[model samples]
Target chain A: MPERSLARYPQAVTDWRDFSDDGLTPTLRAARGLFARNGYHATSIRAVAEAAGLSVPGLYHHHRSKQAILGALVDATMDRMLAHTRAAEADSDGTALGRFDNVLECLLRFHMLRRDDAFVASTEMRSMDDTLLLRHIAQRDEQQRMIADIIAQGVADGTFRCGHVDDGARAAASLCVAVAGWYDPTGVLTADEVVARQLDIARRIAGFPPPP
Target chain B: MPERSLARYPQAVTDWRDFSDDGLTPTLRAARGLFARNGYHATSIRAVAEAAGLSVPGLYHHHRSKQAILGALVDATMDRMLAHTRAAEADSDGTALGRFDNVLECLLRFHMLRRDDAFVASTEMRSMDDTLLLRHIAQRDEQQRMIADIIAQGVADGTFRCGHVDDGARAAASLCVAVAGWYDPTGVLTADEVVARQLDIARRIAGFPPPP
Candidate 1:
């Protein structure tokens, strides 16, 4: 197995501190919680306003409607995910295996660390209007392509012997995205343990050689 | 790879015909659609009754409340999944690899073929009350254990080389369950193709030897 120097990256690239809810506006933060607990269609603007300590009119000043809030949240989540993906790629050792390991670890960590954002962005996609949906889907496709490209490169170089690059990439990404659905902060495994285990499973799926 | 005679099982065991909405009552069928599209928290009893073409009183005769409908839907989906799992196990060649392959294929096919039920059972889980949630969790845990046991047996018998059986099982199951979230009947891949690809991916995740 190839190894990269973790010291080359900034501390935020390897730490969970940057994944907190600090970047979100108060209204978006409150709406994220409400949308996560209650479905978007069931959560009213009044409820979001109350949760965020704003009047309904004041909330409307920031977000035009509930749909707008949902769009903003999903967009923001995807943006952060894309940024982390790029950072992980940049920190890799310029090998397909190294990029695969780093990117998969980054995704699993993001999904588990930002559990609520991931959950809402996944489940509430149906609530977005067609325009927003298309844009979000494009962003998601870019992330999927990142994994597919790595696997393709690996397969070409004989680093990964997987027969099906597209399906293998989909499976790798899908498994990591699922961490948000079942990860428990209070559970037996820490986020690091889960990420490490899943990274191994992903490598195996890609047909990477086991460590000697 | 070990082979099993799928022919030994009844026709329903290997067919998608059994996974249709034929088993649901009219009201439950309507509610399944409503919950899948708008979500459980947003759907009401009146909406379900109207969609089912039943009077409020008539709908009440069958189900006590909206939660009852959701409970019944989730319960029935789990029952079917468990039944299929047992059937797949029975039909296996009595080897760890065989059981893992059959069960993983069965799970992927069910999630894709019965997409709506799987979607509702997964996303609306938070809407179920304490008792219902516990019951549902037990059923889900049973499914998880089925995969874990197979991987553990394989590891012990030298059929699989994967370390961390528990996490491997979770990743295998999680990747299959995620099929329902993204599968499209009208998309490029057919259900058969998707299941075949996902089975290959699951086998790799479990450290099964690649085909020669």
Candidate 2:
């Protein structure tokens, strides 16, 4: 087993927090809540305006179309996620196992804390056009590949022992992403507990014991 | 690690295959495809009827309403999944770890092979009314508890290691459920490979190695 680190990944816009309360923030937040609750296709612009307490024209003033809102949400989610992961990678300086734990912690914590954002981004990804979908997919792939790289490095240096590094990486990433699908902020497990448990599962997949 | 066995669980009409060409099979199949592709709310009863090549009334002859279709899909998925798991438990004869692996395999295979059903059941579960939603949640909890029981038994006998058995079980079940979200029939990894990889991950989370 290797020692795990508590160093935080450089945080990006915390689930779109940097958006000023201006033309689009309220509208986008309403859209995210609506899309997270109702299926995206079933949610109309009128519904979004109603949720945001904006008149139709006012909402239209910000977002040209409903698809624009969906596109923006999906694009921002991928961008923020990838930025956090890249920052984690850049800031990490330790053994491969330590780096792997650091990156996994960052990814799990982001998904756990931003459940609604994650839910809407994941469930509504199909609503995006092919071009936007491809772009988002590329960003997602980069995040997964970064984890894979860390696993490969760990295997190379004899810090991890897994049968297939690529498969292990994919499973670990999938397990982390799945947390967004079912994590309940109101549930028994606190956000911190969910993050800790998921990191434990990641270590198990990496064929290592939890760092003492 | 407790030894895993090769005993087979009893099967239950694998994913609606035994349905005769009758009032509900075609309609349910069409509904699954539509619900999986276009989503539940966006897919209308007329669309399902058209997909099944039946008139609206004819479709209603079997399913009274769209909500009925959604409920039936969700309930049947839970029933089938629970049935498979219970049967696995009944048929298995080995250490707690062996039964755990057996149950996990049934679950992972069900989610992988019945991706469309799993998709609709998971994503459209919210479409069900309060009664149906509660019913389905109970069934889902039963499945989770079964896994937890196996983990508890393993822990009592010194066959598995985890910080929390309940959390381990939830994460393991979640990881299995997520297979439906991304498993591609034409992808590079065969279904067997995916199953093998997931089983390995499950074992790791159970604090054990792949059975050899």
Candidate 3:
């Protein structure tokens, strides 16, 4: 919703960039951890500074405000995720369920790999103002609409056996949300491993086969 | 886990009779709203009391502490949910995926219909001390193990296909979590309608018919 602070991040972060690799500095990491553990409303600059092991001014120098830090976190996460999910959508040229699989895989990966970001994006986005909420909602709708289109196409082609596209879409949407509420990092499966299996699960739920 | 306080509730609650209907009074309602919106730690007795129009003394006169309220909320939600899932698990004469469907349908209904309780049960449970966490983890394992048994049974009978029962169980666990994040009351489907459609999806995902 809000524009990315090109100042905070070095030059452009292309699809090649992985936030876990080098994009996140100590300050950003602390902000993310605090926000994830304690919510945005409850978190304070002092705590973020404390987590980062920096003075108040030091933390403030990197970001404008706590809310801006939240916005930056959202933007950074969404930017990389947008890159990944867009790629998934690009592969959606097959059956309706095929496109659905592509998107579902991306959604699962986004939550698994970026759990904190996923929390910040979905829950903390409510802290955004009206204009930002509209823009963020638009991006979210774009993603949802893409999957909805796939389900609709499946119904039209008779590939997906379901009551209706809307019902299918709701089921699909609900499935993605569950990832955020339940993903455990220290648990059995690695994020990538879970994504591989969940992609297939998502496809079958959509009444389609796994990708060839 | 903290012993659930019947004291936080009124005489009806104290008698442990008609507690199901009348026990969910202003006190529990406040706890539900606070825990859902703010999570466990951030939710305070003062806030809950104010929201419920009860003074701090009055609130404390009921549940001695905030954490106790959370414990009670999680316990009630899980108690009902595990009962339904347990009932669903016992009736496993069909395909492995069919049993999974029954359990999944019950979970989605529990989550969507009782959203606040779901949130408190899943996320806020973490706010409990280590001892409570262990007990809660034990309860979660029981549910997951039940699911794994169904998958193992399906595999043995050649009714379901998966790389591993563990994988299926994990996917099933993740599937249940996704429901809490996105379910909306005013959405197209009623809670019953959503659960029915989700059951269809869960069956397909669990390899209900099993691949030839």
Candidate 4:
């Protein structure tokens, strides 16, 4: 991990001086806001710097380029999401269908919280070089695959009625990508509520049991 | 609507001339290729015109601006998709679930045929103004609402089971958005095969019976 990441560079902007994770929340938050609204292709280092109330050069000191900041944002986000999936799984106790619901719920909540970054990650993978793309896709695919594995286990145990593992994989991936386009944190449904609702939908798609 | 839009426009340097739809199957086809490969924002009118084997002014006589071409292309494609949805509704047998399967099949085939336009439409709508945005979303939401209504109808009839209508609506929208990301027409699956598989998957999500 780059030490100068947004996690480490928040104060670099707000105070017009260098600061790290303990001080960089404002900078990280601002960068996320800009990247979500304008798209990375349309955003520049100067814009993020100004938005956070820092000089362009000030931003440069914390991160080498606009892409570095982007990478840091994405990497940090991916870690948080994957960890959420694990926690959700650990916390839930039920049949395969119940576990499945919990997983989708976890994804929906994470997706809502990181909605803009979710959109950025889904759309901008093309901008990354092969190594970066490979790394990101692996992380992304692993999340889907974990869900797919659960579905596959369900299918094997006769808990769900999927025709193929690939179908489950496809559904899991589609569900995640779908979240980026229309999800709004301010919408009537709380992220917690949404997770439950999406889990219900995911279960139905996976041919699992409806909640009792 | 722009009489002769950018689709038929040749590059500012090319020998192709005029932007009219009259000899246009080849030109529009080329424009789709470029838009798919380079994305709508990065692509220039000159590049589009050149790709079509026409000159810049030749391209311009047809399209007043880059957006005119994009709008016309979207309009043309949306009409086709709407037609496909209607046809799917008409062609399917049995209950609303049957109709939904047809819609899903149509969706898979529609995206396969117009994957480039689908990619463009899903990602480029934010760039359009209110007038175009309204038109696009109206058409898109119309189809989504239709599917949601069918799912809701299925739930009412006990053919499908889900807790909420809004969740069904979200699911339908999410399913469509997912198509833009991972579809590859020339890959292992033929277009029809993909439609068949996706229809099965859609049926499961809607909580309807899979095809016999």
Task: Tell me each candidate's TM-score.
Answer: 0.90, 0.84, 0.77, 0.80
User: Under CAPRI classification, how is model 1 graded?
Assistant: acceptable
Fnat for each predicted structure, in order: 0.67, 0.45, 0.30, 0.33
Candidate 1: which pairs clash?
none
- For residues A1-212, could you state the per-residue lDDT of candidate 2 as single tens digits? 01001011233434332212212256777888888777888889999999989899987776678987787777666666676666666666867777887788777866776667777776676687787778777877888888888888887877777878876787788777778767777998877777777887898887674223
DockQ of 2: 0.34
Per-residue lDDT over A40-144 for candidate 1, one digit per residue giving the tens place of the 0 to 100 score? 999999999999998998887777789888887887788778778888888889899999998899888888888888889888888889989998899888999
Task: Point out where model 2 deviates above 4 Å.
Answer: A1-24, A53-64, A210-212, B1-24, B210-212
lDDT of 2 by residue, B108-200 (tens): 888887877777877776677888888878878899999999988888887788768887898889878878777888999887788888888
Worst 10 residues of 2 chain B by lDDT: B1-10
Q: Please state the error at residue B185 of candidate 1 in Å.
A: 2.1
What TM-score would you give candidate 1 relative to the actual structure?
Answer: 0.90
Stretches of candidate 3 off by over 4 Å are A1-4, A7-19, A22-28, A49-65, A88-105, A125-129, A150-192, A210-212, B1-26, B52-64, B88-101
- Model 3, span A57-82: residue lDDT tens: 97778777887777667666666666
List chain A TM-scores, every candidate, in order: 0.89, 0.81, 0.75, 0.80
Each model's iRMS = 3.8, 5.0, 4.3, 5.3
Q: Find the candidate with the highest TM-score and give its number.
A: 1
Clashing pairs in 2: none
DockQ comparison, 1 vs 3, better candidate: 1
Question: Would you list the C-alpha lDDT of every candidate in the order shown?
Answer: 0.81, 0.74, 0.66, 0.66
